[model samples]
Target: MIAANARIGVARSAYFPSLILTGNGGVEAATLADLFKWSSRAFLLGPLAGTALTVPIFDGGRRKGNLERANAIYEEDVALYRQKVLTAFREVEDNLSELRILRDQIKTQGEAVDASSKAQRISSVQYREGAINYLDVIDAQRTVLAAQRAAVQLAGAQAIATVNLVRALGGGWGNATSPDESTQSDKDALTP
Candidate 1:
């Protein structure tokens, strides 16, 4: 966008007058001995230093085309920038939603693990007292293990969601403010 804007400015400036300046200096020595001689030294200034103002006339629509192209490029860049910003916001929202849902799932899985652990303990006690078969104890233990594994998986998912959320935000959670906070600020600014 900046480059396009600069090109547009340059194209527009082509309509104004331009000033040019030129100068040259040299030495005319017959021999190397006279190279440093003041009389042998020759210089020319101001003879070619006069400013020439060139006012642009008609240009077969070249400048107009350039300006139009630059404007189009700038507009395209602005649109792409807006799209990228929206994509970033969408990713952040997605990650936040995942984190919310995963947290709830983790809590529920944790409760299941606790319940399964209690059931396993009761089954073991019953087996030792001959109130149940050994297979019941084994089954209860397997259920407890499955529940614990599920809880672990949910915790892992929550951690992954947190990482994704941080990545979407472009930095650590501690160093950045939430989008919700920014939205609140925007609302406050809009309030009378």
Candidate 2:
């Protein structure tokens, strides 16, 4: 699958690592759906689960999705905890994996960025000595700009990877301050 590799991207390879986090939205939605299923399952298979705890927040008096009274509380928070822990572990693992990939991508990009910088500098010196024309400066500037963009994108990737790890760690989402928030932002942007 495109997601398994994180490199089968829609954009250029230089930008794909950072863009991979966008894929996390899809992963999160599905995971949340599953968590909701298991969390609410306590009410469904009450006879088997045992005694369900009264989670006041999710099961309020609102007419929402399907769910009835707490039937048999699955006296095993361990089951729910197991589900949460494993899911969290997967998310964190994937995010960390992405971070490693992006880190490598950044290294290559950094080499490019450094080369571009040197080229630009050399071009500037040549232009100053009148060995080249204004066009030379323009080309150097363009290359530098492209390399800088790649670096910015990689920085964004590192940011996204950090946020994914935090989200898996069960932190809240927020603006730029948190990974969960940045993830929501990406998903929101992808939405209407």
Candidate 3:
């Protein structure tokens, strides 16, 4: 938006006057010996300094075309930027949803791990009292290990979702402004 405005400004400036400066200075001599003699040397200086004002009268619509092109490019960039912002928002929402679901799974998995641990303890006690075979205790321990592994996996998934959410939110936990507000602020910053 700002770039387009600046291009328009430059195009308008073509109608204004520009200041220019010029200068020339040199020395002339008939021979090298005479060049070293101040009386024999002819020097020219401060005789060509002058200023001119230049004004553009016409450009065959070239300036108008350039301004239009710049405006078109600015519009295209704004559209692309808005699309990127929307995509980011969508990703943030998706990751948040995943984190919520994974948290629930982790809670349930924790309960499963606790139950498996208690069952394994009971199985060991029964085996020591000769109420159950060693195989029963070993099976109980396997169940506990599986449950714990599942809980760990769920925790890992939750962490990944959190990281994704942070990335989608531009590496921060703060809420983002609406797209309109963001666009306005960006334009304000870009403007001269």
Candidate 4:
């Protein structure tokens, strides 16, 4: 808003016409008769001459129209800036949503990983006791590996979302020594 007001002030300046002052003086070494003849032309023939004021009397509203156009452009720019800010905020919100969902997915995947590992261990014991074949043990191992991979992928997605959130929020969090400043853990999350 302050910026918009400043732009309006700049546009308003155009209403103030430019002031021009001119003065001319020179000795012509004229005789009395020549002075009378020159004086008939106007005051310029005198020893000293000057225009007290010189300004545009009329421009057919061109200057006013230019100022109006400038104001319109400024308003357009302000609207564009507002739209950009809104888009940025929306992006931040979306990233935050993704992060929240990913956090839950990671937690669920972790549990799946743990359960798969336990199944694999049980299958191994069964194989040793001749209750299950080696193929069953291998299948259990594969399941555990798949679950672990899914958890890792979810974690990676969370990190990417965190980075996106930070970028959407304009990157700067707070002063370096501020309590709410980004910590090493936050920096670590942003790292690839």
TM-scores, all candidates, are 0.78, 0.47, 0.64, 0.69
TM-score of 3: 0.64
lDDT of 2 by residue, 66-178 (tens): 11111112223436667888988899899989999999999999999999999999999999999999998999999999999989999998998898788788786453357
What C-alpha lDDT values do all the predictions have? 0.86, 0.67, 0.84, 0.79
Give the least accurate 10-residue stretch of model 1, judged by summed lDDT: 42-51
Q: lDDT value for candidate 4?
A: 0.79
- Residues 1-192 of candidate 3 have per-residue lDDT tens digits of 677667667866766788777665455678776666667644343424666678877989877787787777778878888899899989989998999899889999999999999999999999999999999999999999999999999988898899899888878646779899999999999999
Give the C-alpha miss distance for residue 23 in model 2, angstroms.
Answer: 66
Residue-level lDDT of model 4, residues 1-192, one tens digit each, is 566667677767767765545555443535656654544443242324543444556879977786787778788888998999999989988998999899889989999999999999999999999998999999999999999998988988998899889889889545546544558658879999
Which residue pairs show collisions in model 1? none
lDDT of 3 at 183: 98
Clashes of each: 0, 10, 0, 0
lDDT of 3: 0.84
Give lDDT tens digits, candidate 1, residues 124-160: 9999999999999999999999999998888888888
Ranking by TM-score: 1, 4, 3, 2
The list of candidate 2 runs beyond 4 A from truth reads 1-81, 173-192
Instruction: Predict model 2's lDDT versus the native.
Output: 0.67
What RMSD value applies to candidate 3?
12.9
Residue 64: error of model 1 in Å? 0.6
